[model samples]
Target: MRAHYRGWEEGDGPLLAAVTVLGRTGPQVHFDGIPLIGRPVTAVETDITRHVTDNNLGLRFASRGDLGLYGLGVWVRSARVGDTSVSEARIGAEEWEEE
Candidate 1:
């Protein structure tokens, strides 16, 4: 998984992001990025095996700043069962705003 933060300003606070797979003892990874000072960050867990039961994937983001007008992009790549190649297909995307 990869995450990118864009349009960061000078006063914006650093953002904390984490990814977790349900039933797992710990998160896949947790990272922080400061606006105007951070680059794209990637997290990988190669030991995770495909589960036969239902599993939940979680994403969490937090910051002390108001987070005004910033762009966040997250990409998750995985290979299909029995497929050796990974697909770059995007599942969905949307824009949001707060009043």
Candidate 2:
């Protein structure tokens, strides 16, 4: 699966990116490896500026059986590291696949 960020905060900060499927307890998949069932997902921390729409954040997986359609939810959290801090977040999702 793949995700794109069309709009983003104007400046740099610690960034958190995650995706979840409806009805699931955690993130949809892992960002660094082939995904399998029952593995826990973690938020990826990175530079927010790299998340533009052209730089697709994606995941790959191996499913043993037929997979049905499901909704995808994307979340982004940004936090400025300082004594007086600022934080921002956004969430979006859609019915994302067909089989």
Please report the candidate that would top TM-score against the real structure: 1
Candidate 1 residue spans exceeding 4 A from truth: 13-84, 88-99
Candidate 2 C-alpha lDDT tens digits along 1-99: 222334356686433343323222324333224232222222232322233223554422214222211233333322333433222222333432211
Residue ranges of candidate 2 with Cα displaced over 4 Å: 1-43, 46-71, 83-89, 95-99
**lDDT of candidate 1 over 1-99, digit per residue (tens):** 333333456798544342212212212322222111111212121111111011333332324211121233332333333424232211112232111
Q: List the residue pairs that clash in candidate 1.
A: none
Going through the candidates in the order shown, the clash numbers are 0, 0
Candidate 2 global TM-score: 0.18
Q: Give the TM-score of candidate 1.
A: 0.20
lDDT of 2 at 80: 31
Please give the RMSD of candidate 1 to the true structure. 14.4
Number of residue pairs clashing in candidate 2, backbone atoms closer than 3 angstroms, sequence gap of 3 or more or interchain: 0
Q: In candidate 2, residue 35 scores what lDDT?
A: 34
